[model samples]
Target: MSNTTNFKNLAPKGLRIIEQTDSLYHYARVISNTRFGYQPVSVAYCKDASHVQYCVKFCSQNNKAFRIRSGGHQHEGMCSGNGVIIIDLSEMNKIEYIDNQPNQAWIPVGKQLDSVYTELEKEKQIIPGGGCQSVNVGGLTQGGGWGYSIRKFGMTCDSILAAEIVLANGTIEIVSEENQPELFWALKGGGGGNFGVVTRFKFQLSALTDYVTTFGLTWKHPEDVKEVIRVWMNLHASTEVELDPALSSSCTMILANPDEKDLDCDGIRELEEGQKSFVDGRMGGQFYGTKTDLIKLLKKCFGEDLIPEDSKFTLLKEVCYASKKKSLAKSEKETHASLARHQSILANFLNPTSTPEQEIRATNECKHRNYRVLPVAPTSTCDQPHPHKVSSSFPKKYTCDDNSEMTERIYDFLSKCCYYGDVSKYMSFHCLGGAVKKNVDKRVFAFSDKPYLLQIQGWWDDISNAFDNQSRNDEYVKWVKDFRLNIAPFTEGSFINFVDQSLVDHPETHEGLLELLEIYYGENNLSRLRKIKAEQDPNELFKFKMSIPPLIE
Candidate 1:
């Protein structure tokens, strides 16, 4: 725990190394620093590719495993381990335009997507990537970056022109289709934290558009969830491509929050003895055209003759970069209503005079993101990160003609929702198609071409409550677990980015995780990726919960 530790002493000059006892070490090491815990030997921040090369060599010489860290929105906290050395890449973020090729740019793996977007905005170019602003370029593109423009442009990896990777042997290679064709193929849309430390990415940028027509529609009647999902599958998903590749949609069925009047003190902390939550659904997306054409197309899908009375739609004012902020003015109204509810909920436990300040603090702390625009402000950095769990699946095509069965399943899924307070639980479905299908033959990324990706999420205050210390965490995870099982019969595969390892006894070698691997990278592509791993990292030095393993034991 000394200032001049061996980890620091061994580091190449100019590299930043922090000991385990340092406050910065905690923030530098983990993003999803959950209550379960991940302890690393030391955290080293690499300024450039040379630093990464030295760190890998240093780890090998010291008989230690090393994990990569980028935006650290890394699901499962896989960046940390008992005796691992963390190659922290947050400091390496830099976006530089390739002057020779005006349409091309070099982006560091460590830069968050929002920061990348903010930087690229000046250039008036775009990269079809993530909307969840905090995710980094390395982790997201590694797992097939999908976003509003994906249908128009293809996955994030598809836009890459080249990359600079530092391998296990500390050799830095400039990889691309022409140079290291095999390595280039593997890096494009391959899962994150695998292969090697990708220090820099050379991307082919697309011209930015002025305004993207985005829309949000919700079903008024909660009981209509079943019929609406059926109509979506029957009308929208089946033939979206007939309209235009630029148009896409994502529909989700979620548990509705309790009425604010009912969310009294007992409901916020300890739930009322027996209050029930309702189920609702939302469907929304964007198009590469004007609002008029978007609405005309929506009418075609919903039935031009007669739009459903229960449905409501709105066109957002935000452009392509902020396209995901499709929340209408109504959502803003809902936010004010929610704040009022929170104020009342806080009044129960806090002094009346201090409630306003506490409520404001709670609102800011929540990181309210639904109405956020471009340069989506990220939560303030902190050493003490909160804990949460999420899992996802891909149902390639919905064949369930029985609306009642789907409705019953939806009810059953929401039935296990938080029985207590303001803690939230819901399901999110994102639409997939367009260039995804056209680009499938490219064989570059891990994520498959699927019609829909479903996110099963649960969030709570902390690790637990007073009665059962781990109950809250257990409950949140179990909800996703049970929901996964219930929907297993319907879903064909799982999204790699979701990173659920509850079934894999040994992610390093287990067949169960491998089964999910086939779903992610496909058997043939996976074989190719494994072969590359075998040759590049024969000893499997860069192994973690979900990192690609070498060909053999």
Candidate 2:
């Protein structure tokens, strides 16, 4: 049958095709809407994975480029391209609790993270996942999701017990540890939309215990801000707290300060006193809210001298003071895990040196100029091995006890952003060589093993300003890649979920993708992955630029 005829017959009976006026607009919508700048050729909203198979088959027969979409949350939009047929799985939103008693749930590919969380909460259970509620389980789980529960439990990939996927040839297969185990290994943390189109995920749900505590703290004075960060890094490194605060360690240039109006006499005096030691005079600072022991820690870090006038200290103190009062009744045996769970706490130790005043300002300037400030940190902060090859923190060096060289290497990376000269303030989080690394199976979520999960962002309200010139954009991306490359010796892996698409053209940095495969499937099992990719996708029709790269010779 003709390709056109096949597509017509394959589409769902009630499915509408707008080829005339709305056709281009429909495709354009998915393309321009992606977080990454990747352009899309066309888009088809599938009613189910069966519809996805039909779209794939149709694109295959026509020799057209294609991409898959499941709640486009990937920082790098692998689901979009110039002339690709986008199989949007947004319509396949069905979530079912398979076993409520055992805390097992089956979720379709299209359902957003928030929807899943809401639905699952009704059953008094929750799946371990990321913060972005709109993200799809298919992509997030495949990439080894990490969120609020990351420090407490592990990742979304670790909790996954099984999955149902549609192969390239339109055959549906259930993959798990028992069935097609090798594929299962590759699927977890291998990056999604590569092996096959996932339809549903079987998540191992856990009992939702304790109320999630959240708060935001802000600092205006450079010196006080530095002090706040310095103290946070040091405290987090040494102290083991039951409550984990997902700290935002990125630099910011505040055009408008929300706390500026609220500041009064006492708050200003405290902040000024805190800045007395530093050459720069302290101005103001405030906490948006308070949670757990975070307030006390902040106070201890900055000291009372640096507090601002008319600040919200009374409320903060009241909460912390009350919480501590309540905790006195409990036993010391109800202990929480500490910073020791991580292999290294260099981020905290080197916090003072890396994030000093001048670099912070420069990073803030980068934000002002809308240039991407890349975040760099110690490999010890990561959960697994970093993608970097030269100096690694994972597979702890028991033999070489003196880690001064490794420490220096980390300081240098931190210095790139924290120090006085050429400091970049791109954001990154700890994801390597910690409890998550030692406890979880790296083969299942190898990407998380990397020392750092970075978010290289350039904030600009103007759409025309981002890529005004491709060369400038290229330079910014290359600089971030260079930062990653420089750390390759220390870090042995990279987080795929945090990958920035602008750097996809650079193959060397992406070497982590290959390393990820090795960690999961092992050298022996790689042949099987290649064979499956070849057999299921002979034309390599379903492949994305950053998905599964052909195994090199």
lDDT of 2 by residue, 1-553 (tens): 8544455556876544333135465444342222245544446777766777777667866787777778765555566676556677777788766643457777887887767765554444567666555567778888777654565556778777888888877778888999987677767766778778887888788654433333333444444544543343333343244223332222221222111233433344222221211111111111213444445544455566654332543222211112233222334313422111110122222111122122223333233322344333221212211111111112222112212343333334433332221122233333322335543553445443333343332221123123344454445455556655555554443356665433323444557655544543445545555665665566576677565555433
**What residue pairs clash in candidate 1, if any at all?**
142-190
Residue range with the least summed lDDT across 10 consecutive positions in model 2: 384-393
- Give the Cα-based TM-score of candidate 1 against the true structure: 0.79
The Cα local distance difference test for each model comes to 0.62, 0.48
Candidate 1: RMSD over Cα atoms? 9.4
Could you give me the TM-score of model 2 versus the true structure? 0.64
Tens digits of per-residue lDDT for model 1, 193-285: 678889888999886554455566555354455566666655435643443667766666655443323232234422123325445566666
Query: Who wins the lDDT comparison?
Result: 1
